[model samples]
Target chain A: MKKIASIIALAVVFGATSASAQTLKTVKDRGILNCGSNGSLAGFGLPDAQGKWAGLDVDFCRAMAAAVFGDDKKVKYVPLSAKDRFTALQSGEVDVLARNTTWTSSRDTQLGLNFAGVNYYDGQGFMVRTALKVKSALELGDASVCVQQGTTTELNLADYFRANKMKLKTVTFATSNEAIKAYDTGRCDAFTTDASGLYAERLRLANAADHIVLPEIISKEPLGPAVRHGDDQWFDVAKWTLNAMINAEELGITSANVAEMAKSDNPDIKRLLGSEGSYGEQLGLSKDWALNIIKLVGNYGESFERNVGAGSPLKIERGLNNLWTKGGLQYAPPVR
Target chain B: MSIDLRAGSPPARVPFYNYPKVRSIAYQVALCAVIAFLVWGAASNAIDNLQKANIASGFGFWDNTAGFDISQSLIPYTNQSTYGRAFWVGLLNTLLVAGIGIVFATIIGFVVGIARLSKNWLVNRAASGYVETIRNIPLLLQLLFWYNAVLKALPDLRDSVKIPGGAFLNNRGLFMPEPIAQTGFGFVLIAIAAGIVGSIGYYIWAKRRQDKTGQQAPVFLVSLGLIVGVPLAVFFAAGLPLTFSYPEAGRFNIRGGIEVVPEFAALLFGLSIYTAAFIAEVVRAGIRAVSHGQTEAAYSLGLRPQPTLRLIVVPQAMRVIIPPLTSQYLNLTKNSTLAVAIGYPDLVQIFTGTVLNQTGQAVEVVAITMAVYLTISLTTSLFMNIYNSRIALVER
Candidate 1:
């Protein structure tokens, strides 16, 4: 029994090593991009009843495909749960993982992966019903909080409570939907998760208006896509796709005006749209890669507002996700 | 197929080296070699993958701060505790649920199984119905029903049902008073220990004295006095060094009570009820295996019906019941992993679910979790095996 078990384990390890070494080439040969996603999350990667995928994460993968093949429609979204997301990306089962996964130091340094860039600057926050009249998280002494299990949200809950020396009782569930449902039905006094998730989950509540998100942001949760190491070409493509979107958003280049802006006289705009330099080719793509991405999926601001921001049902305010020019932390280096 | 074995024995005396026994030994050696080779190959492959992934492989992560909170634990645990300590908490919680489930499953199984053999129509039908209904449903679905349809269907915390002893009940769970062991509670522990020892000594003495003389002492009364009456007398002597910390009804929820969270309560109910159904069938089969002549003979020897069932039927039924009962205990313990589905922080949930996700040490986490469950099952089987052997039929 032991020998048979070990043989199977060995087969798995050997199997996991293949084809992943050349992620970009495999993706190109497959003629379709496979992107990992969180299909259950409302504003991030949920699929509609007709199986059409829509979310900020979905758009990010579409933008990658647009950059590579100049057609966002060629990408396929593979919905993944929290536990399967990282392993899926690591095993080369997906070309890119665009789930709303947090970019942590451990994930970046040790997971043989590279986080492209922060697409959402979310932080741990608490949500309570307005009827509770609770003003601050600190005032929530001995509060019963509902949280999703096996996520960083639970750890942050412990840290925030312990640092403030407040008593608390936590009710945990296997998924965000389950946890939010528990909180909605008065099983807990407060619901806690990322600020972005709090907004999305509040929209799921029976009385969305009754809940209020606490102002305190306890922990930094920089959620973004990640690519496996060794395939530097794929990593560069994933990283630059995000950078191009931010730069386009910063340069006032909307999807409708990107083609016109590519012809601008300004050197910065010209280089950003890949008109004056080999920046796109440096990442093994055409000089017009950024222009293709912008045309297909729009810039960062457009995607955010269209998916999770006020333009969507989630109505999540772009607090820290806004660009640096707007007093937010989102800053991308020059295309040059 | 390659062996030249048309004759039962070689026409001439075959060399001992080519003997079947020698060939069998060689085959066994070859099998061992193949197994060792496969294990080595797998180990090397695992090491290579870990290096390629840049994931350091070691047990070093056990000492790192867990930084995660489990809702229910039998041992002291906190976010600040080490991962090693969190593992212990997970282990203890798994044992706690499985241990409680085993005891309750046995009691319910015996009762229901015996009820099925009752002469009354209603009693027998009820037992069979319970066995059929509970055993047919999947354990996971039953857990969800217990958690959502039953426990969660209770009123909100503010509208908690006030039970006796100042306890509160709601969707949260049953909140009973916490017993605070005050000063001198150690004396109560000593008295209980003494009572157990005294009862055991008296029973042994009575058995030996009965063998020597035909006079049977009042062993039951004397042992009961030491075990029950002495403990009561010492409880007054110790000034009752135990107080109840009743949970106060608060605006949002109750406070300061020993709250049995809904997750744990639901899991315990599901595990015990589901396991009892299987155990009930096993018990019924064991009881039915005994010949009707055994009961008749006991009655013919002037033993009453109740005493006949208790002294003759039960002891023999136990001999048949114990072996399958052990596996049921093992099954119940293993099924407690279903606690993962309902948010119970069992060993698999806290360590494999949360810690493995946080650290991305799937191989290590899975190995440890597997080992823990194996140890628990093996220990339970070992204990049950001893009891089964002790009760096995002895014939000259």
Candidate 2:
């Protein structure tokens, strides 16, 4: 009799805790989209002095919000650290993780998450003081390097040194700010991270012009947004949102010109603007989903130039982030 | 028929609820059941949540390659080592810091504590000021201050401050020459071991002789000769088979020596200094808890100050000191987790921080870490309790 009573109690507790996975419905019911983002890295996902977030990753999250609610301001940004980002996504603390996280096999399968698509193509590189007069990473043998913990940068550093048959010493910190501080204070000979992160972090140094990023690119870092697994509907919503931005850019549709181009006669532009077909309806969204994304968040190129390109302080060249038609890796599938 | 009914009849009227034994047993059983239910509920809920999240749950990830390098590892480890090996490496590093920190804290604590009780006004004020200043501030802030303000403020790697005896200091770390023992070094090691054993045996024999006869032996002098003089004589007779491999400055860093990374140095100093302050208070309280009558009694018997403190007062005060001193030791060990903030790669930093992120096994990793700390704390308590019992006062 006691055993049956305890079993009934256990069942009640378990039933109350198990929630079904309907991210879109829950997010809509809440009337806001929760986006996990890097809040400190400038030109990627940092907030301004007024607490208004502006960056490429931040723009991606805004695009997701625009696609869902038709209003880009329906987002609440949750700043996350590198160590907590995946856990935050997995635990349903956020609807979509638009943080600058690299898409890797281990993360995709092991962490129970799915990568939507690569938004910023990056690679790891080294930055050193120019006064050292060292030009190449090979000259960094027996050098102490500072890197952030729980990132692919740490692993790539070790692999690079081992492959080149050079001794390496690492001093890892929990945050990029600390790593950069250590490097700036001369605790390390070099600071290593993604090339985009290097450019972004360089502006924080006391003497930004004294440091130079090396020419060597060690590993590929295809950073993108991620969503929880087992939600194909939510996955489609995120994947097509990125594809819409890329296609809009290829079709030469700017944020200012998106309304005028929506009335064009071309099949690709009409379909992308949700006028030629019921593609948005298939993903359980309104007919103007892609149109709202372009009008609100602009195309990928506009986001890039505004956040991290020639217009921003980072001044990073669009080496691999350009469109596939223009000799780059960003090739989004056709909406049709 | 003639028996008096009142003599035995009252014993038969007691109810079971009135029995102390039955009531106590029922209460204990109820408490155990409640505790068991709570634990089972929590475990099941965690498992259910993990399954719902589709996260892999088990200890199977321990065998996976870590692929991350640690700044300081006591054991031999590379990026290719398994997570299990990484766990051990991290555990050994944590133990190393705790062990060395405890010894230094105890020594500094005793000196400062005794100084606080001194008649000299300057020494007493200085000791009191140190204890007040260090203990009132948070340990985390002190650790950061030591790591950033002090150690990182040292000279750059290119302009290392060379210390005598083949050592160099820089912001990177302090590097010293490593000793290389050749084939004949084993004889010297064996001699040292033999000398230690001989000293112990001689001390026992001397104590027995002193107890049996009215004469005393020069036990200290003889033991010192056996322990120290024998090792020195053998080291010279064996033609000094030990050689030192000194560190040399490279283009980027000082290479080819045992480099004690600044992270370890900062954590060690921070833990030792911060913990010594509290330990000083504990020692002071313990010594004060011992009555002053014992010291005055020794002085009345013609014993001087040093002998009275050593032979009469300290022994009794130790009975009061052992328990709280154990607590300070445990606090220092647990506070070593602050190693994460400065990248020292202690157990929590490496296993729980890095490995948990890579494998995504939060439950297993966290459980193991908690168990490790529990075991360390319990073991420390167990040893201290045994020593406490030995020195406890005996009932007449």
Candidate 3:
């Protein structure tokens, strides 16, 4: 009888403990971070021919690995679709979600997730073929549009059309590739997605020069990384990793100059680089957590330039992602 | 005789455990208990896990505003409608596809099945070739072929090919004039319904007269006259209270008419063609299952080949066809869930995909989806079973 009671107790404990434990400890014990990522979207989280991932979101996961294990390569990228990303994070299938997911209020409160901070400030926009001769989105009245399903863009498109009092016909696909393909085939007058995605996907179109992204930024889409709720330590670590990147960029700490700057006498730089404070310790990480992130993944601006900015094929201008000191919104609180 | 039978029974009394009735009941009770325990455990475990994960549970999210647009909706729906309404729209779309797919498949299947047995070499080989080729390839690939290769290969919107009656065909879809019923249309609709009832009554009376007297009545012509001719006459007499709204080509789109989107058309065509191949095989086997003796018997009765096959062979073949035919119908309905692959916004795409994503209620959404498919399948089986029973052979 006692043995049976003990077995029942063990079962109860095992059942109660799943997905509610400290994520950092679990990740450390597992020796790698499982990062949910977008495997298709270029300049974000796509994998190349050699199976090596290189993008802004990919660098975010690398930064997390650097902060936790002092090695940026200790990450396994779990590619997820827009529909499955949050569930993957919530179910502990991925330790962190660095996909290009929007940080909406409902997602923050409703899903069991915490958006660390905005890494890319984007907005919904439309892409149309040049032959349409349509300059503004308002001219798309009574036109059919192709959009990706399970995305905030779908809702935004509907709302935008209804607000404009236009008759909208939408064709939503499961993936952005399908949506873009359908649009290219003249199945729709326009394809709507994030502005950044539009630029990246335009490169994949057959007649890349024929399509143009519309000038209307209809919805605020602050894309960022997220961690599961209930683990504040894990949340803080993810949040600070992004903040450190932004702060590094603000402090003029590029990856090439990060080692030189670590020896600087500036108070903020000293605290951030783990020379003057125990901030990393408080977040249950090594003293050189932020230092490793800077050394391995580079600062936020460097990552942006290499992945999606003028240095890359996407050639997206840093309009909203520029640093606060440069009159943009990519600001981080002082490390000290 | 009773004493001898009792003496032939076991010399010793059988134990309660050895009794067949007691053993069967005991085993059944144990199995039921085990099943109940497993179900309870799973349910509780799911509830506990959901609570631990901090994800809200239940069907409360069904009432929430969906805030999404469906490309095609049979009912009046907007983004402002609730998720429950979106679910109905998706279900209706699925039903529409399944219902049309079944009808087309049945017609094509019966024709092809009969043709496969034709004496003409080309027709038999062609029918066989269609069945073999279609049923072998995967359904998803067929759907993609239809959507991408066939339909998308049509002309662009600006270069739309014009069809008769103010219709246009483009890669986007087929655009046709929508019929708008004006004020006195109700009377015309009522007249048609009355005509249908009159035809059914006339068919029954004609069948009875043929049984009573040896003279056969022209039931087909009269029924057609009652159902179609009466409606047409009434429509003309009522001064044609229906007008068509023709589509106008605009700068960006062809606007102001009913449109059949290519995604829906492609899904319908793919499902019908693919399912028809299997249905044809089932039909062929069913017809072959009726022995040559039946055909010989019909031929010996002074009946012609067409009448023999239609009256004698088909009725018997139906008994064999129905059980498998029910399964095919169920398969077609369930396979319509693949609408998500091509973005047709069926129940799986709308409720399970979009709503589940928006609400982040995976457990609730998935459970509801499963329950819905279960109900649909069971309901289909129920109706098919009833029809089967009505036509089933009664034995002594």
Candidate 4:
């Protein structure tokens, strides 16, 4: 009788304990971060020939892993589709969403998601076949436009057409790839999506010169990292990790220069490198936290150049994503 | 104490309740308790999580301004409209697609189903081939094929394939002549209404006269003439007022015409073709359910094959066909949710997806979507149940 009672008691205790523990506690106890990403988008998040995930968004994931575990390799990348990203985060299926998700008011408020920081500034634009002799969106009035459903681009297309008083017809697809296919086969007169997406899509075509993306940016899309809301501690850690990357870049610290700069005489550099103060300890991290991130994923500039900037095939211009010192909008708060 | 009890207790009686039955009831009560506890636990957990997130849990968001635009609204809608109004638009679109699909699918399904059972070798094989091919493939794949492979291959607007009577087909969409109503349109409508009422009255009178006398009334001829003649007379009396406003090919597009967007066309075509295969099978089963004896009996009574089928077989077959047919209609309505997959901006696509994303009320948006779908399913089921009961067999 005593043995049976003890067994029931143990079962009750175990069940109650497991149920009460939060995802944050589990993540900390496990000593690794589970990061969600886009497995196919080239310049945003993609796996290379060596099976190593590399891209601007992938770097943010790596940086967060480094900040948390002091080892960047502790990240397990879970590939997510557009429809599954939010649900994955909400269900604790992933620790962080470093996919190139747009930071929008509805997503932030209604989806119970927290935007970490803006990493890429993007905008919706239209792409048409150059042979059509269409120079601008205005020229394509009454044209059949192919757009992906369940995205901000759909709403933006409607707004643009309504504002311009153009009686355009639209065709919708579940994915951008399908929409591009339809457009390529001459089903739609135009395809509309993010300008960065257009660049990525055009590269996959048989002839790159056949299509041209229009210059009119119909909507603002600030792509960023995201986490589930209601956990302020986790939100701060993710947000500051991105900010540290940008600050490191502005301070002229590359992955190669990170170790040397740790011995710098500058007070701000000393403080950032944990040489002058113990700021890292305040965030429940080691003294070389920022240094570890820079070594593993490099600074923001290095990541951008390697992924979607002038050095890559995407060749996106750093119009608004550049540092404030370079007359762009990317300015981060000082670490001190 | 025992010695005194022996005098009073002469015989022992068994308790009223049996142990086995009591045990069974106890086990059932425990099972019910476990299930209830599980459900209650889940509900409480969800409430706790939602409270922690500070998210409001209700249907209040439906009354807020949608602040979004739908591309193809049958009714007038702007960004300023409430979310509830947007839902109505989506619901209307869903009904429109399902209603049109049912009519077309029924006609095609009945013909094809009969053709499959035909004695003619080529016709039977052809109908069988269509049913087997379409029924095997997934609906989503079929939709993509129609939207991408077939429709996308059309020529550009400048080189649009022009049809007779001022119609144009291009990669964009199909543009055709639209009817422009003149001043006399009201009279034309009234005349059509009058013709409908007159035909109904004539049919009843003809049926009664046939039953009373041994003479046949040409009900078909007289009704057709009344319905057609009245409308034609009104058109002439109203000075032949309807005008065809043919679409003109402008520099960019065909102007002054009714445009049917390619998305809607592709969705409709794909849905109808896919659903018709299932409907055909239902029709074949329903028709086959009618006994062979019924056909033989009709033939022995001097009725021809056509009249035997029209008067005897169809009525009985309808009893078997309707219940399953109602389910198919519900399937079509639910399947319209897949319109979001292709960007048709149906209810699920426009309201639950786009508006939900723009508004950020996950719980509310999902709830409203569930309610809308539930209402549609319930209403359809209710109507069909009433129909089924009316056609049900009555036994003495």
Candidate 5:
């Protein structure tokens, strides 16, 4: 015991790099991926009646688990609120945080976390009642808007008002539900949040049809999985897992057809599924890592449509989240 | 219990560890050492984690721009203000609500406490019912009820209800006329101040004259007239030089009036009304704890009913009341932290909630907030303790 203790002390004195690089080993020993996700947001990271988690964010974590373990089901989802999301990542409480977290500059640089990739390209938008006769948020000169406090939405709202030289009255609430309730009860002329959040929140209003989300998306909100910054190896695993999903969607691979596509002649397809090279091995995984992800969680397009896209209750379009070939921002580097 | 020691013996000595004083000191040292070790361990662990994760630590984040607008603030705050100014703004707002809530809660508490002991059955029962209902429910729900059920139920901007003082009450808030004191208003303020000084002089003289010759002076009436008449005479003589900025109903909402946002009102109303119930109970217990015989003794000494209650019964009752009253006030101030639930921009809401989220420096932000609350609580209790000593029973 004394010998091991001295060795650990020596290791600490030199550097904690070896000490910090055991995340994958720990997950493998535990046999389950610990994923932090937003527990309350619908069509993004909400649990159903039976405590079954499902969302665009939820699917990304599952995809990560599948890449490493060849089984997406080996994931235990831990729910986190927005304020605690970064803390959860920094404290090593979760292996990967796939909550609907915005990748802001301060958060990426200072919060000891690295955003993997933009799984959901969202923007802040406003939702107003149909009776307000408001067309553009720019028309809301003297309007009182309700928004969740402690969010980037507050900063964005202030910025939008200042840039346009308008007076704004923002009534903030602790939670989105309270914000919606305040907006529903006529306390505010409009409710502002991420556009995806607006759609999800609009569903919980007293009468969803009475409200309309304004077309103005004021600020960009790129949300994705995040890992602690020190472990670039784990960071790569998380980042490339997202890249593989998007690449699989672009290459016409679904969960069902991924196994058959392993025999394809195309070099890119062969390389992506780990049939042509040792790219997966370089990332500290077996050659068939991407193949496992595509097989278990389907491609990014399938996950999106299943959780928050056309097939889901939110019905959000793949506007900013589509592939670069489809004129969207979701471009990934080649597997080679 | 006497055991004999030889005259030649140096005192019969117990080992230093067995001495009560030594034992207590030893125990204290052990406790402190354990606490220090725990703190050092936790801090080292946090520093290690922060370094490994590459997160920044320290108070440097206070200089950064907040980039958020609060709905209401006592001091002027904008997105351009640094986090330090936001901290003061939030602390001031918290003090504002807590100060206002303390005054209102005290006034209502005393009245309801007295009413609970009233001869009228209806008043007594009603006061009891109020205390039972309000304090029984959680303060958060009452805040929500006031915010959602009462305030939000008001008509929207276009159909705002107009009040008599060039004010409007809508779902947004109560918008009232802001008094702009111009050039002549200076004289009015000076006259009022002179009147107050003059009243104090008159009070001393009246008391002295009454004691000397049993000749009563109409001091109350004269002081009231002087205070009001001076302000009024100066106001009219200066041509009533005060303009009001009435809130004008605009296309979307009212513009250009002092606004008591629904958030502040809801939190203040909730804190006062809820805490007043507990204060009422404390007050009742104090008043009841006073002997009833004192009131009869005051009557025998030729004191009237009001004077008897005020001079004799209340003074003794206060000795009991003030201690619990201090605690209630402290609780009310601490309860003001719940303003975070309703977005009141109080210290906890803005500094801890918003600033912590923005900087992600939880340890620094939370420590500062904890220190602020401690300062407020300690200062309040100190003042109360001094006041308590004045009324405390003098026993040798």
Candidate 6:
């Protein structure tokens, strides 16, 4: 009986190992990254008229594909809701999660996930209609507050109210969009969420000028890309790809200027461009790897501006997300 | 001749064949082995992957400080609180929502169920309509509707719709008068307790007198009078023990009275409405399961319709209602996990989501959450089972 049990265990181990191996090889063979993203978050991840996924998060996925196979277009974007995103990553249904996920300790540790890097700095804030004449969150003590369920915003709102010794009613919806709609329909007195989200939502509203977002930030929300925890190799690749984008922006290597910089005589530039040394080999990729990423997807700044910055309809100010050299929190490690 | 027959029988011994009992044992063993193998393989693979990534795989992370604040906690918590504390807070919130939901749902469900069978056409149709509509939609969707479409539309604080008696309603929540305890409140509470015990004793004596002498005493009237009259008499003797602390409008909020936030109200409303629909079905089926003959027999004994329902029908219906009702309560408890969806900071949102992220103890956090839920579920089942057995029909 013992011998039989051991034999069965061995067979099961072999089966699982082989299955994972098969999936890995298949992903490599396909030469396309299966990326998960938020389907309807406008500035983060959303589809265009051509049914092509586009956003800061979507670009990050494309950049990963570019780094891997030298083609930004070689990505299959799987749109996922907040609930399904982590499960999809754990099941190997997606190569990486580029959805706008907050890097919480539980999700990182318990859910077997590794957040690559902070891509967007967000904090919870409240938005109310101008007609209400409410200035600060303190002014809305007895007001009905609308919030999305299944996110950190709900907890943050409660903390804010309790800290101020203020009492407010909370109206909750499952989706952010629903909450926004409820607020629009005058069901709630105010809608609370991350400031960035408020901007995105306000832009979606029919009358944007009527809503005013409160200045108070109640919670720290660091949204980023994430991957499954078990694979260090994969984790490193995803992490550094994000770092490279940040570094590229700081170094003034825009997509239009990247090809010109690739031929530079400067040793750091050469190394970064994969023209002099073999940094790509260490990461199991070709020379000019990062250059391909820059040329195809542009730097992090470029992605941000196009998707959610001054040029975009959302027109959100890049306060904390700016480069460290420009007085922001986005400082990357030296490329050496 | 007997010796020869025995020798011939020995010569004709049959061949051994497969035994049914042995086959059954083998099958069960194989099934168990398969399950064990799968579980082992999964665990080993997870461990191997975790080791490769250098991530610690244990519950030691639960002791770490959770550098996050929960908005609405029953217990005192801060960024300095341990992950364990956060788990407790979240569990308490979940239980709070579920406990409140079950009570409200039970009241609404029974009322609506009986209303469906009422003689008034309008009342019956409305009750039936509510059951059909709510029962068809998913609970999550209904929760969203109440939180978003319904609650979000409330007016701002400055223009909060004033109800009678200084009460205010807005998006913030409901504000009403709170009773402020004065110096003699303790004495009043003691008197109320004394009144309850005295009433119970009086009721027993009244029942015994009626049983012995065939004179039906007004037990209920006397008990009610004792309970209320005693408390009132004590209250006046203690020089009026409580004062009304009505909420007054402040610069930003209402002052004085306790504030019930909109989140709690919306969650309670959503949970009760959703669960009540299921409970209504359970109640209707229970009422239908009771035989008409029982009602007829009560009527034949010259009992009124109300008495027949109270004494004969409801007692029988309760036996059928109890087991399913227990399940509905369990469902309400589990469904309260959806509080996370609307940001109620129930166990899943605060502990499992925020605290787990801050501490990086996924295994510990999830395990603790699962255990808390399991304990709640098991305890509820144990109590409900006891209640069910008490009400169940005893056969001769």
Off by over 4 Å in 4: A1-24, A48-52, A78-84, A104-107, A137-144, A155-170, A265-267, B1-44
Provide the overall lDDT of each model, using Cα atoms, as 2-decimal numbers.
0.84, 0.88, 0.88, 0.78, 0.86, 0.77
DockQ in order: 0.42, 0.36, 0.38, 0.26, 0.38, 0.20
TM-score (all chains, Cα) for each model: 0.92, 0.94, 0.95, 0.88, 0.93, 0.80
Tens digit of per-residue lDDT, candidate 2, span A99-198: 8898999888877788999999999999999999999999999888999888888889989998999988898887788889889989898999999999
TM-score of chain B of each: 0.93, 0.95, 0.96, 0.87, 0.94, 0.87
First chain of candidate 1, TM-score: 0.91
From the highest DockQ down, the ranking of the candidates is: 1, 3, 5, 2, 4, 6
The structural similarity of chain B in model 3 to the true chain B, as TM-score, is 0.96
TM-score of chain B of 5: 0.94
Docking class of 2: acceptable
> Model 5: per-residue lDDT, tens digit, B13-52?
7888899999999999999999999778767766776677
Candidate 3 clashing pairs? none
TM-score (chain A only) for the predictions, listed in order: 0.91, 0.94, 0.94, 0.90, 0.91, 0.90
Task: Give the Cα error of residue A266 in candidate 5, in Å.
Answer: 3.9
Per-residue error at B240 for model 1, in Å?
2.7
Per-residue error for B167 in candidate 6, Å, reads 2.6
* Candidate 4 local lDDT, A1-336, one digit each (tens): 112222322232222323222545666798888999988778988898999998888889889988878789888999875645665565566778988788887688766788998999999999888888888888777776887765778778878887898776666665667678778877677888889888988898899899999989899999999987777767878888888889999989889999899988988777777787887877767788888898888899888988999889999989899999998889888888
What's the candidate order when arranged by decreasing TM-score? 3, 2, 5, 1, 4, 6
* Model 6, TM vs. native: 0.80
Q: Whole-model lDDT, candidate 2?
A: 0.88
How far off is model 5, as Cα RMSD? Answer: 5.0
Please, what are the lDDT tens digits per residue for candidate 3 over residues B1-396?
335666565678777899999999999999999999987876787677666666777888889999989999999999999999999998899899999999999999989988998899999999999999999999989998899975568998888999999999998788999999998888889888998899899888988988999778888898889878988898888899999999999877888789898989999999999999988998999999999999999899899999998898998999999999999999999888888778888988887778878988776776677778889899999999999998889887
Candidate 1 segments whose C-alpha is farther than 4 A from its true place? A1-14, A74-76, A257-278, A286-288, B1-18, B209-220, B250-253
Give the candidate order by descending lDDT.
3, 2, 5, 1, 4, 6
